[model samples]
Target: MSSPPPLPERVSAVATLDDPVRRSLYELVSQSPVPLGRDAAASTLGLSRSTTAFHLDRLAEVGLLAVEFRRLSGKTGPGAGRPAKLYSRADGEICISVPARQYDLAGELMAAAISESGQSGEPVLDTLARVAAHAGRAIGAASADLSSALTANGFEPRAEDDGGIVLGNCPFHRLAETHTAVVCSLNYQLLCGIADGAGDAAHTIVADPDAGECCVRAVPVPQIPQ
Candidate 1:
């Protein structure tokens, strides 16, 4: 599965729809049972083909619309002419929030946990912890560094003078507020997995919940004497 766009990208893509013409084109294409060609869209909106095509392409550039070329006529290659460009709504979801909420990520993790628990006969919470950690590990491994990984996941990581890290925002803030114990535990496990996957053994993730911040902190790992 593919990850959703970063918050900024999603916000920008959504902002493109603020244009009245573009918004109308998007609505028309999305609501239609089938993809629409530029000519068809132009006729329906009472606009010139050039104007409609420009706005449609603009929407596609922002990832709000999908584009494909096909021959509207049910004819073969003999002399079918050029394929028409059809536009439709793109796949995937776009969500934007001021503080950045990731209820969708939380829901995905929980759903996976439930499915695995049902199959393996394991406790749901235990399965949830495992899956969340696995997800974090993937994020860390794919990112260029720890900070990038955290930022990508909406953790909003900040570096401390002592070489520690503080999370300015919790992606799962809403869920954590309602289900403190479960969500916090999941948060800790996920961070630990991120550290492991990032191959940064110097940091240890600990639950140190504070108001308006993530429930966990990344502190320097304690040294062990041989």
Candidate 2:
């Protein structure tokens, strides 16, 4: 049989950091203005040179750390010895959400709203709601299906006998609890956006907050006055 396809870039990058030595090396290289050589990193962190080389190579393989072969010594030529390998943070950004609730997605919407409102003199809340709804719809439209997408996002969607869906987990649990109004409103608009995004306009998301569940419910879209 053929070998499996590689994991997604972000997933592989995040996985590399799970190793303590690699995480430390990444942090050290990232914090430095100059790229770090294995010798410098190994000595600083009190690890053997061979061990550092192994972890550094692993990080480089995952694209978390950029590698360059250069002489740290001020000399060049055959007598200068082999060029030292250097490691530094890569240009890529890695973010992986296992259950897939995208807090970053939400943050981007809120940030845009704040920035535009500041520049245009519009109320922040107004801009925020508009941006969030637009984002939601776009997200929903691209989603696979209501139940599958919700579960993937850690929403824990459950089918109801009444053809509605109950969310068993609040992906934004902590944020919603502390900043109830803003977060709940954001969540509702996002769900609404998802519905629109998924091209499921007939399904409506309503705020039906329960004691320990998500604050929104997915139901059939309501009829409007003609």
Off by over 4 Å in 1: 1-3, 223-226
Q: Give the per-residue lDDT of model 1 (tens digit) for 1-226.
A: 2356877788888999999999999999999999999999999999999999999999998898999999999787889888999999999678888787778878888899999999999999999999999998887787777777788778889988787899999988889889989888888888888887888877888889762389888887778999
Q: Among these predicted structures, which one has the highest TM-score?
A: 1
lDDT (tens digit, per residue) of candidate 2 on 56-80 = 9999998888999998887897799
Clashes counted in candidate 2 amount to 8
Model 2 poorest 10 in a row by lDDT:
1-10
Predictions in order: lDDT: 0.86, 0.78
Query: In candidate 2, residue 177 scores what lDDT?
Result: 77
Q: Which stretches of candidate 2 lie over 4 Å from their true place?
A: 1-20, 43-48, 61-64, 68-85, 90-105, 221-226
Model 1 steric clash total: 0
